[model samples]
Target: MGMVLVSHSQARVRTHDKCAPLLPLPMMLQRNVLSDSAPILLSILLLFQNLTISSNQSDGSDGEVLLKFKASLDNPAALDTWAGPTAPCSGWKGVLCGQGRVWGLQLEGMGLHGAIDVETLAQLPGLRSLSFKNNDFEGALPNLTRHRSLKTVYLSNNKFSGEISDWAFSGMNSLKKLHLENNKFSGTIPATLTTAPRLIELALQDNVFEGEIPNFEQEGLKNFNVSNNRLVGQIPRSLSRLDASSFSGNDDLCGEPLEACPANYDGPTKYDYHDDRIRHHKFPETTIAVVAILLGAALIALLGVCIFLICRKKKSHQETAPAATAAAAAAPATEDLNQMERGGESAAPGGSEGGKPSVRLLTFLKEDSEKFDMQELLRASAEVLGGGVFGSTYKAGLNGKKMVVKRFKHMNQVSKEEFNEHMRRLGRMSHRNVQPIVAFYYKKEEKLLVTAFAENVSLAARLHGNQMSDHQSLDWTTRLKIVKGVAKGLLYLHNELPSLTPAHGHLKASNVLLDAAFTPLLTDYGLIPIINKEQAEESMVAYKSPEYKETGKLTKKTDVWCFGYLILEILTRKDSGVEQQADVDLATWVETAVANESSGYVAGAAVFDQEMAGGRHSQVEMMKLLRIGLSCCEADVEKRPEMKDVAEKVEEIKEREFDDDFYSSYASESDMLSSRGLSEDFRSINI
Candidate 1:
């Protein structure tokens, strides 16, 4: 039997054997050739149609995710390239496409505002890098656990706050760099962050995190920080290898790099020791009785001596009263006669003729000047520079020499001996960065410090004050050098005087005077020890750390915090303003700018000094400096890097700038050579 076949669109057509028997087999075979391949052809067409549908579905899903993300923005004008019905894979801004799907979304520094649409953006199956740095994005962090393929999540410099969920980073095993610095994030750092086995860098500085730092001993973890936070307790032993700056700002923290924990200290405890049995056992009966008898005998002897001294002082006062009155009446006339003859120099006033208080010039260095008295200081030509937290400062000229004199306004609690000790300590410090106290005057009514006058302006004046027409504005290179110099000076103070005044308790831009060569000279060092706590607080209000507010004590970390703020001030040229205006601080302003910039807009540029715009500085390099600045200003003091680390980082930035310049020049020279047909010679020189 023979069969006949025919073709219909996508359907098979065959003739039965009964019908086929009527036709010749060779004729049917020749007629059925077209029909023979119908099934295979139809199969190919159907397969192609299914593939088209699948592709359309994927494209539609990606488009929907992107649209939803755009809809979430508070300002969409910055993302004009993302408009229209064009597919994201075709050429959307910040959207990278690969393998027929969205591969990356790098919209950093965009003026995008509002909360991020993390769920919608996570729908893109191939998305690897999502950067929202320097944006105005607010609200709690979105759930990113489902985005398993994300490698880099840069959400720094934002207003994102609230405690991050413990499971926030659970599924992000592929993440390498997670930068959340300069944000308002609060609460303890998630332990889940340590679970991310592949994380290379983690920056959580400038947040409000509390509690002990979690152990991040992972082999791959290289860079980490939690500085300027309210974190307490010892730094994790695993992290002890990091620089002291990394844990600088947390006042309550203690460990090897910082002040060691006291021997009896067992962390924060609620209960006091009031047990009778334990007290009695510690102090045996015989020892306690012997100590009590000795104390009583000492008290009796002290009382007897007080009576004898009081009687003798009364009799002496009665006898000396007449002579003191006669001396007081004649002192002014005698001083006027002496001043007229000695050309304004006279004996110090307010003392008796025979018992005049002698003026002593205590100095750490050898004194070459003739014996000078307090009368010389009073007679010197003096101009009031300004009043500061410590006291009023004066520029004085005496014997053709200029010096800065600071008269203490609120150091009454410090005695003569204590003031002398402080002056000697400061005089002994001869570091190039620290301003040495050349001489000091101690009296019942006044305490004064004398230091060499810096010929150039202070850092504060250079940054915030009006510029002179003849003087050039500080370029990026100069600014960087100043910052590095300041860091070095602070490091020297912290390292050399860790036991005395480990931190510059009153570090401010105004106190950082620049010498003729632009070298930073730290002033107001070692003042915290001599000033009362109340005075210290009032004087250092602008530079005080958050922990200082609560504990009323300053640490090395506090100085780190102040330095961080100073860096921001230098970069932005904005006054920290009054403490009443919390949002006006350079830190908050910088953080906001950083957040706005992360979304692919240039919002962060708003905080930079306008003059910096004309310089040859790279925006990328500026951003790196901003990050470093923000890290120093971290709310977690323990997470702040030491001044040494900061100096090194700044040095690294300078080196990076040099490298960039070198490469750029090299490339330009190469291009010029290529145009001139001398590229072969240039290439040969490389060999």
Candidate 2:
């Protein structure tokens, strides 16, 4: 949506007039404000210094992750340049982070190579942006659907092959920019994928797609590309307006701006050419045969004409056919819709194909169409409630049978195959505090995920004042237990188990599904990364790392920062505990917090009251955790920690809390169920 008009800067007629193109753009914008070159160099140096500092300090407990990432970079010089001391995170090249995590990992055109594993990157929860353009990467793309906060994914100019399958991008609904141009992929483009609501740019040119182009009409696509493929036949006119370049280079492709095949070349050129040869090679014999047949046909026709005339005359003499004969001879009972159009009645619109319409009947019919029944879902939900991202406190039910229904929003951006893959993956996930997905449905493009909905609100809900006043809120001991339980879940995702693929990419309070026993169940664990294509850029501003605003790359440390933020949100029932802008770095808050700790510095009392008050954890401990978050949000990748260390420290913190009496008070009575509601279930899936 933002527009930047760039031209040469040298032809400066005057300050009010347009400048010539030869002058530098940076100089043109700053010339009037500054008279010397020293300031510009200083500013540039500061920026670089900030990057170095961010890279060095990011991901407090995940520095191992950074080291591994740095080792994979093509240009090791970048590591030396940006990983030095005294450098500021803002000055780092291709590094961005917020609240202490590595959020953006844009190393475009750095000549990065070597085999890459997506699992290494998945460790960073706070990552929301990634870019690896113009590289020598090979093999299939890494699965990034777990990073819930991700918004931009740029992986163009690589050596990726195979068909673009739905499983590759299972939950990337919040993704706004997906650039996969200039690859070596083949096979038909999945029809269900083109309808992402948040998508703005789609560049799939120079691939080998061979089927009908999927529908891209409804998406907010400002740019599209499908050229240089094996695609044949007429291009969809709906996409014709984009640009000729988008559909150019396919020899078999025709129609729209491209020229159509010549009208003369009809009925397969080979057939006509062969027939013409037959006409020419046997001309004499064919001519004689035609003459003889014409003579014979003339004699026969004369005789037939005489007979027909006699019959016609006799028929004319006879009376008109009887009504009974006419009735008996009426056309067969097969439907003649064209005749019906002229006289027969038209049934009412929206009626069932079998009979009259009713809400109950329609619901029943829709259920029958699926592999399950409707009434069974209503009865189970009356007994339990659950919660996740879209909101808090959703009730479950089943009409009569022992079914479970968990209501959710139709995040219509998810494609059918992607949703199914995500559900299957989620279903297989084994964790004490994570709910497994069963099945989901999408009707009219609305996405609803059916999971084993837990029976209670998250601990954050209680902290945020969601429970009844007399309901006896969680005591400090119970809160500590809850933290430990959640920490265990995080540890499992971060380490503990060697994952075959990435785990939860997004960690947020709203995603913390809770059972009646107060056990934290992380719902939508892997959905965040996949649903990145769901909303606009603005909608993701809150959850996205500061680095994402500049270069889009999600690092393991980014997840660390998000986990830290989740920790804050849990402790303080709020999402905006810290906010960082693209232009103004997150380090500002870090520096302020650090400065206030000095003896002579004047501390902001409000910040102190909110961040360090009451019988909560000691300021040193809180600051340690905050620093961990800040380190993870550091603008540099090399500075972040590995999840193993973070999980260790989190475990330590939780173990210390379990000794309190509050840990003994948690309720424990909920049984996990598989399927939820039917209509609500069917209407929400996007396949």
Clashes counted in candidate 1 amount to 47
Worst 10 residues of 1 by lDDT: 662-671
Q: Which residue runs of candidate 2 sit more than 4 Å off their true CA positions?
A: 1-372, 378-393, 399-410, 470-477, 487-506, 528-536, 540-543, 572-575, 578-627, 635-638, 657-687
- What's the TM-score of every candidate structure? 0.45, 0.39
Q: How much lDDT does candidate 2 score?
A: 0.51
Report the C-alpha lDDT of model 2 over 1-687, residue by residue, as the tens digit. Answer: 112222123223354364445644444435543556567675775566566555556654444555567777666665554554423234567777675566777878877776555667777777788898898887776666666467888889988888766545544656678888888877777543453446677778887766656546433577888888767666666676776788887665666677765665332233222243653465688899999999999999999999999888776545466533444333221112122223332222122222221211112111222334222221123433444444223333333323233433435566655555445544545678766555554433334445554555555456564445545455434544565676677666544212212245556665676677777777556555345354523333224764555566545455555565565444344443443344533334434544444332122111232421323233223333333444444444454455655455444432232221211112111100111111122212111
lDDT of 2 at 102: 69
What's the CA error at residue 420 for candidate 2, in Å?
2.4
Error of 1 at 119 (Å): 77
List model 1 lDDT by residue over 244-312, tens digit each.
Answer: 887778777888678888888776432111222542457779989999999999999999999999889
